[model samples]
Target: MEISVRTPAVEPRAMWSHSCTLDDLVTPYAVDPTVVARLEAGPGWARRWTAVWRASRARVVCPVPDLADFPTLASAPVRSFTWQARQRHRPGLQFVLATSRMHGFESLEERRLLLALDFTGGIEEVLSQPFKLRFTAIGGGEDHTPDFLVLLNGTAVLIDVRPGHRVKDKDLVKFAAAERAAASAGWRYLVVTGWRRHVAAGLDALSARRRPMADRLGLHDELLEMVAERPRRFGDLVEATSLPAVARAHAVHLL
Candidate 1:
């Protein structure tokens, strides 16, 4: 049997372009063939991706199985951590405007992913170490914890952060289980192995406008009106605006 993976419906955009959505910015890493083969080894492995791997059948603690009940489910992170010296991975807290709180990250990659998420708008909340997933695999019962749970535009997204080459067979199994768990909750799941081409560079450039700036002159509308007619190169776009020097900052702010 041939098993196919679900790919996110996101489009790649240029660095200066404001055409992409939050979903577009957070690109999913390419699937690995070895990992796919390992996940597809078992007889019923393909079917298991849609199964519920919750805490239990009686009590649903992870989140709501329906989108309507999602709002009523209030939650804090299921796990906590303490910083220690000589650790292999860097752990720190970053203040995200979307949540209006400091969210935790286990590694630099995770931190970067958080920044990318925050850079895009419409992120309602971000919780680190959201819940403990109990899954039944061919091997047996295994528990796994996801990195982050992001509520974007009334939709929940479960995210796991691991480098592309660092993903092992066990990791694939856990991610599959997480996907199943997310599916049960009417949510989307993403395994962020790495960024897409030019995304890292694009994000870094866009970071300059991440924070708010005073636009007393209302250059945002002017720039929007100018760009609406046609796409312009970054340099030319700013120059064509009413106040060339002032429009430069607003141009990036619009992005």
Candidate 2:
């Protein structure tokens, strides 16, 4: 059987400045409280966010690409992966954005990292498998398609998720090409890994606060005062709010 491959016919334009840093180019995505509340109330909230609550809040800095002028990758053919029967049993996830559109994930890891990014107070937009770019001139040229394209603060980031142990020689070449493509476009490229453990728990804890009910019950202001005064346990913080048990529970989550 004959198989055909697609490639970029023209070289992409170099739009990004060499001296710009990721932080300077892209800001983190902002949280939408309404959207968070909706997701929290939806079915399977816990399952969806298992890894999100474990990722860290540390800012990631790198070179960014300029994606505004590039064509969307949606036109590219979808790529397929071959895995053993055991791997096929892994569940997929769908992320619902503030806009109510859904972005699908093929693995739990991808879903978790995406949730973390969504929960991040700094990220503004998240797109999955947005596009593909070719890196070589030969037949059946190598192509790099990032897993997610996110708009952080004000900058764009092209992210790829993989386990730390799975990164190999070929992956390095692909990463290098991705880096070059991202830098040229004034966007940042990221290879996501086990770092979700750093921020997920904190995010899950704070997600409850995104509900407007927290504001209505005065839990918002009260918790702020208590935490600002001195460090307190989550339970104590909840009790200090003077809210009822249910409200206290919500307040505790906010803390």
Candidate 3:
């Protein structure tokens, strides 16, 4: 049997230009120097803390979309990845956005990042390759397309994902243009490169805990209570439970 789902509708906005300074992109959130100083005392803390701070503070300059715009934005056409297979058949993955459409990702990296985004407790909605934002560049008018448009904490964020090695001078210019556009719209902008290993792994493990059997057997509540008392290994948690061997294995898998 075939199932059909309706794509949400979005209203089109007029294109406009906005300009921003380098400093505007430098710090998206206000920073406390004292906290930074304390964190800097630890080995490798400065670098790690700096990255976290930048990501957290990344400011949006775009206007928050009203509730009505969600359906339209969620229904936006995903960028085609058909050309990608011409070079090599890298397996693609699709995400079921909060809006309920299957949004495709061209690379495993993008998929992993999407998982991370979905696991982010604060994210309200996600729209992939949502819309084009036009901006003025050095010599002419240019159009910039961000990879994802995210709504969190009642604000909008424009995200572009690129690996560090592939970032070029021209790409920086494009990002600058995108940043300005985001600022004008009262939204924040982010250029995501790497994922935090622990965060990604934890979310992946947590996502696996959604099996119906876990709930039916009361293993879900038991496991949560055990973990809350103190961190426990998967094997230990399984052993602690009175489930049969096969059931124990399944429970561990869920954990």
Query: Top model by TM-score, which number?
Result: 1
TM-score sort, best first: 1, 3, 2
Clashes (N, CA, C under 3 Å) per candidate: 0, 38, 16
Give candidate 2 misplaced runs (Cα > 4 Å): 1-67, 71-91, 96-99, 137-140, 196-198, 204-218, 228-233, 243-248, 252-255
TM-score of each: 0.72, 0.58, 0.59
Spell out the clash pairs found in candidate 1.
Answer: none
- How many clashing residue pairs are found in candidate 1? 0
The predicted structure with the larger lDDT, 2 or 3, is: 2
Question: Residue 56: error of model 3 in Å?
Answer: 35
lDDT per residue as tens, model 1, 1-255: 233434456645454444555456554654455543433345554334322222322223433234225332355555666788888989889878777788999898888888888666678888788667655666766778899888877677888998766777688778876776676677888888776667788777777687878888989988888778997788999988779999987887777
**Alpha-carbon shift of residue 40 in model 3 (angstroms):** 36
- Alpha-carbon RMSD to native, per candidate: 6.2, 17.5, 16.8
lDDT of 2 by residue, 1-255 (tens): 221212224433343323323322222222223322322223432222211110133222222232455433223213333356667534455544443456666677677666565444455666666655554421234656677777766567877776555555455556655655666667777766444222446545655454445356666677778778887776777666677576576664554
